[model samples]
Target chain A: DAGITQSPRHKVTETGTPVTLRCHQTENHRYMYWYRQDPGHGLRLIHYSYGVKDTDKGEVSDGYSVSRSKTEDFLLTLESATSSQTSVYFCAISDLAGGPDTQYFGPGTRLTVL
Target chain B: AQTVTQSQPEMSVQEAETVTLSCTYDTSENNYYLFWYKQPPSRQMILVIRQEAYKQQNATENRFSVNFQKAAKSFSLKISDSQLGDTAMYFCAFMKHGNYGGSQGNLIFGKGTKLSVKP
Candidate 1:
């Protein structure tokens, strides 16, 4: 089951408020990723980390930021939430093996902005 | 940049029957990976199967298998003996095989196809 967990399974906040989502993994994998799932768009990558203190943005990282201070924790933060930012956030982990690295996803967090 | 496409937005199959979900991707890199992920109503994304670009042989896991056509850039998932539990939203994803910062190890996914298995 990848041993992945996301905190605040469901959250609601007002516009302009800052929000952070947590993704924790017990597999000790080297790769972690944050993605948002929206209708008609499916899943879009927001940010990912390859190691501790190493992070980078994805295709739709315009308003999202990420931090990875340890091997097991990766956090995604929205400096200012907007109504359009509401989505189901998913955290995935991969070991980056020599061959194909299959990613395992977490339960996902549903966020709503008013 | 690479893009994955799933033509079917929704599909249905009768229990005990077989169904195939089509996925097409565009990539210029020779080294990469393809995967099919299933997201049930529970909201958990599960890895159903994966096929390596270098390997000609298709990947199989129990009732789940993939038809890898590298030339056509087509990867289709075949589910045999479909069951009620097979109903879920299936996603097709692609990832390049390298450590190129954010681009590496990041999966580009398609819109997804909803599969309904009826009894």
Candidate 2:
């Protein structure tokens, strides 16, 4: 659907530094999510937003924070980057209007914490 | 808590052949959804297919299909006439129906099966 796109397809940052990854959607989906995929752990949800200014944490939201100032964007922030946080991050979307909402994913952002 | 398990860490299949990836999930809820996502080397999570628990018929997309045994909590994916492009990391996911179309639920995913389709 060409709904979502994650910026900085790849990123490398030093430890303890803060980094923010952006997820932009064109389809105007009300539901947006952030997930991290690591070897042996599959994909773990970091956070999700159901509407503008309405967001909630997921299973792996400890080291991350999310913001949804607008419906088209959901930003994931790493307060202090760590090697353990290095993984491929994926952004997903779902229609909130109703019905069975199938989640669509973005290409992903490979983050490297040095 | 819901959990998804994929015992097979990896598998291999010859081109134009057939292969099956096994996935089992544990969920207390009776109504939910099951999904299969494919991630190629490009690292994009593509929605391969999805099945609603209320539906008796399994979900199928072209050569890709599923054997959803709701009673046994098993959702296995079958790839017929597998192509080289099918080589990728396949994930089995589960979602329990929440307040509204899973508005309050998150997709619980299994470790994954890395399928290697050889030519």
RMSD of each: 1.3, 1.4
User: Model 1 over residues B1-119: C-alpha lDDT tens digits?
Assistant: 79999999999999999999999999999988899999999989998998889999999999999999999999999999999999999999998987643577889899999999999
Off by over 4 Å in 1: A97-99
Instruction: Report the CAPRI category for model 2.
Output: medium
For model 1, residues A10-104, the per-residue Cα lDDT tens digits are: 99999999999999999998889999999999899899898899888888999899999999999999999999999999998888552467788
* TM-score (chain A only) for the predictions, listed in order: 0.96, 0.95
Per-residue C-alpha lDDT of model 2 across residues B36-61, encoded as one tens digit per residue: 99989988889999999999999999
Q: What are the Cα lDDT values of the candidates?
A: 0.92, 0.90
DockQ in order: 0.74, 0.65
In terms of TM-score, which candidate is strongest?
A: 1
CAPRI-wise, candidate 1 is medium
Q: Which ten residues in a row are the worst by lDDT in model 2 chain A?
A: A94-103
Error of model 2, residue B6, in angstroms? 0.5
